[model samples]
Target: MALNNTYGARLVQQETALGAGVQILLLALLGSATGMGPAGWLTGLVFAVASWAVLSRAVHRSRLSSFGPANRVTLGRATLVGGVTALVADSFRGSPPVTLFVALTAVALVLDGVDGKVARRTGTSSALGARFDMEVDAFLILVLSVYVSAELGPWVLLIGGMRYAFVAAARVWPWLTAPLPPSTARKAVAAVQGVFLLVAASGVLPVMADAGVVAVALALLLWSFGRDVLWLWRQSRVVRQQGAGRVLESVAG
Candidate 1:
């Protein structure tokens, strides 16, 4: 048993190391193609190191014997996201290479669909894989939002920050951590955030039209989050009431 655990840990470390290697290689290519600046290099390096560390820890805790195919797909998507993030950071120095940025983001978003199917088909789905995928999706949207915010306004940040905000709120209100019932609508709303942001970033639309598209995305995200929060709040209230009822019964007895 101990030997198996050692093997699993070693395997996870190797996979994450390989992921970091890929991230560095992508950054090198971006630098060569675009003369990416120091900010881009720094940001990409930070992302690679952080991703490797966090993913290694998570997999170790989950005790997975192998890093599965679905996770590898998600990791690849994450590498693309790192490139996109570096490009966004570099944009502050000058105009971004819009075509390259869009291409990387597009591939990442498309692969977002592929990972789940791979997981379901392979029967290797795990909580760690799902969480890894969700975090990558969220970070990519956040990066895209930052890029668009430069054009639209800071108000555009709400689209990127909402999920992180919810996570912070959960720290205070533990009930917010409760498992939400799976809603297809919620998933759809989450999926479109990237698409909407990508369109806005593509610079093809008129400013007014781009703002409108992002505004709609924010509204949908607001509604989806509001519904989930309301559900959790109601569930918490029911548990409290049931606890009180039990106390009353015991007192009566």
Candidate 2:
């Protein structure tokens, strides 16, 4: 077990290094093409380091023998997300190269489904992997939201911030953390967030049309979250009722 744990830690360290290296290379290339500034580099560095820290901690806690193929795919996706984040941050200082930003985000979104399939095929799925995948997706949406919000108005941020807000709620309402049954509709809603945001960021559509699409995305996300919250609330109520019944029976006995 100790050997296995050590191996996992080492593998995570190596992957983290590789991710950081990729981040640097991509940022350099982007700088050459688009003329990035200190803010861009700084943002990318923060994301790279943060991802590395989180992933390393997860790997340590997981204590697996290997990083696994699914994680590799996720790591690659994260690298793309870092690139997108840098581009988005840089946009605050100056106009970003639209094509590059779209390309990076598009590839990351495309690969989002691939990692799950890989995990299933390889039978390497774990809580850590799932959480890592989810956080990456959420961060990407948040970054894209920031980029799109510049044009569509700050209301678009709700689409990105909703997940984090839900997590925060879960802390106070532990019942909100209950697992939800699978729903294809929920998955579809999540998948479209990046696509819609990317389209908005592309500036290819009419302003009104872009806003309409983002509005739809936000609506679907809200519905999905609301549905889950309702389910969790019901489940919590049932649990409380059952517990009360058991207590009353014991008291009568």
Candidate 3:
């Protein structure tokens, strides 16, 4: 983690360099305390560095408006993810470590929304901030998905699958690089999905008991995506019509 952090052009930035150092140090402490040994420490340190790199960039770019609050919250979220991961790992005995992982995952998921909102509210919105937030989200989700899939046999997880699918499609279709634009409905669905996932992961639900609950949540996400797709299609038509009408008016005038 230290080597990679201080490597390349990224070291040119003071914030990145400093954040990396801090991350490396903390990761060592985290590993030593958790009895995660050298390997686990290295893995966790890598994650910590990644998170620091992102948040530091966001800070340096001045994209986060409510830094006071956002920083505190994100730090908390990070602690939760790392702490719970260790706890669950230690309890490799009874029940699934799914509960700890899920709880940690929830914090990461929730932080996604909180950071965005804070940026908007504090008028600190910027490309750097968005990118930082997005990277954090992608990494968190990816890690959690990998862990979950390892624990619970993969059924049909769109969280990880959708990201890979979109990325692959983007490579083949240049136009896929264009964003589909944000939608509140999509955000709502994402939030709900996280909630249900966390709850199920807590192991609070009976093995067969939460099946209906999980199913319903999945259905909701599907509907949300379907609705948003239709809305975006209509919006495209409207945009095209407006452009055409403007051209005709200009020609006539």
TM-score, predicted candidate 1 vs. hidden true structure: 0.98
Worst 10-residue lDDT window for candidate 1 reads 4-13
Q: What local lDDT does model 3 show for residue 71?
A: 42
Candidate 1 local lDDT, residue 215: 96
In model 3, the Cα lDDT at residue 78 comes to 60
Clashes of each: 0, 0, 0
Model 3 Cα displacement at 28 (Å)? 4.3
Residue pairs in candidate 3 whose N, alpha carbon or C atoms collide under 3 angstroms: none
Q: For residues 143-190, write the lDDT of model 1, one tens digit per residue.
A: 999999999999999999999999999999999999999899999999
The runs of at least 3 residues in candidate 1 whose Cα sits more than 4 Å from the true structure, single-residue gaps closed, are: none
RMSD of each: 0.8, 1.1, 6.8
- Superpose all Cα atoms of candidate 3 onto the true structure and report the RMSD in Å to 1 decimal: 6.8
Model 2: lDDT equals: 0.90
Candidate ordering by lDDT (highest first): 1, 2, 3
- For candidate 3, lDDT tens digit of each residue in 45-140? 656666666566655465333344444444555644544444334444333345445645766776767876776787656566555555455444
Question: lDDT for every model?
Answer: 0.96, 0.90, 0.56
Evaluate residue 59 in candidate 2 and report its C-alpha lDDT on the 0 to 100 scale.
75
Top lDDT model: 1
All candidates: TM-score = 0.98, 0.97, 0.63
